[model samples]
Target: MSKKENAAPTTHTSESLFGKVNYTWMLIGLAVIALGLLLMAGGNSSDPAVFDQKEVYSSTRITIAPLLILAGLAIEVVAIFKKPKA
Candidate 1:
């Protein structure tokens, strides 16, 4: 046999790091995180002298926003670790 005939053929396959579903989940998580950040922002008073304790310490900003952020982070972790479908 010739040297060329003895050599094995090489095949190339292209693949993505993340699947469609994984990307979708990642997007959802990002949206949730953005929402949390938006909720956490904007406690500024119109007047420099006036400080609104209620607005600054609202339950939504203090409690819900952090929870949403944490939940989004957890979702992101799950998405990253999830197995892609063959």
Candidate 2:
């Protein structure tokens, strides 16, 4: 037999690093982070001279936004670590 005939044919398959579920989770995390950022932004006064401490230091900005951002980061970690189904 010739050398080429003796060698078995090989097939290569391309696969994604992450599955659909992981991508979905990542998207969710991104959305959550974006929401947190939006919530944390914009305490601007109409006059620009006046600084509203209450608006800048509101519970949503100080507490909720940060918490949401943390939660989103955690979700991203989980998504990165999650195993894809075979």
Which candidate leads in lDDT? 2
What TM-score does model 2 achieve against the real structure? 0.81
Q: Which window of ten consecutive residues has the lowest lDDT sum in model 2?
A: 42-51
Return the TM-score for candidate 1, rounded to 2 decimals: 0.81
Clashing pairs in 1: none
Question: Model 1 over residues 1-86: C-alpha lDDT tens digits?
Answer: 99999999989798988999999999999999999999999556788798788888999999999999999999999899998999
Q: Could you tally the backbone clashes for each prediction?
A: 0, 0
lDDT of 1 at 83: 89
| Position 35, candidate 1: lDDT | 92
Model 2 clash pairs are none
lDDT of 2 by residue, 1-86 (tens): 89999999999998999999999999999999999999999556777788778888899999999999999999999999999999
* Alpha-carbon lDDT, every model: 0.92, 0.92
Give model 2's clash tally. 0
lDDT of 1 at 30: 96
